[model samples]
Target: MTLKEIVDKLGATVGLGADKLDREEEYCFASDLMSDVLTLKDTPVLVTGLCNVQTIRTCDMANLEVVIFVRGKRPTEDMVELADENDMILICTPYSMFKTCGILYGAGMKPLY
Candidate 1:
């Protein structure tokens, strides 16, 4: 689903990249470790409990287009600025990681194979 659609369905609030909210994301990966995400090849939406600037750097290195911070953790100002610099869409959801992943997966989003 498109980022905009996901936001609408989950009632998530956009933290960054508001203008690019309509961008389509075909896949998702849930993790807090940047190293693991760096190994991924397919472009996907990232779901993490992490809310730091390093997450933005990892997203840049991994070529991810979107990040949804689960459990309502707010991204720091530095992270938001870095995400804006990297052109990544950042969002926050009230759902826990497991529930959020399930919801997205049920909605047809998958991890990169």
Candidate 2:
């Protein structure tokens, strides 16, 4: 599905603009463990509750295109800058990790299993 669709479906607030949010992401992986995230294959969209700079770094390392920070967590300015520099999209949602995953999954975002 498209990133815009995912944002709308999940009621997420995107931090980036049209240039960044206008992309398609088919796979999604939800986790707080950066090490586990490093094991992923393609650049799947990520749903993470870890509100740290490393979260964004991990996404960069994995070539992830988007990151949804669950539970109302927002990334630091440094993280945002790095994400922008890396051409990554950042989204924030008030939903918990479980609800975030459920909402995206229900919207047809395949799990990165």
Candidate 3:
């Protein structure tokens, strides 16, 4: 699914990188554990609730492009700045992590495992 589609479906707000919404992703990884996230190989959309600087840093290390913050978690300025520097897309969704995962999966987004 396109990042735009995910945003529309989840009624999420774009915190940054709106221009990059056209990016396509078939897989998604939902986790708050940064260590677990680092294990991902495919460049899937990261669905995480851990809205911290480390999240952005981990994405940078993993070279992931898009991140959806679930349960209405918003990014801090530092986090946004770091993500902006990395040219990554930041999305905020009001739904819980489980609902976010289910919605994306129901919409044909594959899971990492």
Task: List candidate 1 stretches off by more than 4 Å.
Answer: none
lDDT of 2 by residue, 1-113 (tens): 88888888878898754566668888898889999999988778889899888988888888887889999998888988988898888899889999989988888889867
TM-score for each prediction?
A: 0.94, 0.93, 0.96
Give the best candidate by TM-score. Answer: 3
Cα deviation of 82, candidate 1, in Å? 0.9
Give each model's clash number.
0, 0, 0
Task: Report the poorest 10 consecutive residues by lDDT, candidate 2.
Answer: 15-24
Pairwise lDDT winner, candidates 2 and 3: 3
Please give the CA lDDT of all the candidate structures. Answer: 0.86, 0.85, 0.93
Tens digits of lDDT, candidate 3, 1-113:
79899999999999999888888889889899999888888788899999999999999999998999999999999999999999999999999999999999999999777
Comparing candidate 1 with candidate 2, which one achieves the higher lDDT?
1
Cα lDDT of candidate 1 equals 0.86
lDDT of 1 by residue, 14-106 (tens): 998888876777888899988888988787888999888888898898788699999999998888888888888889999899988888989
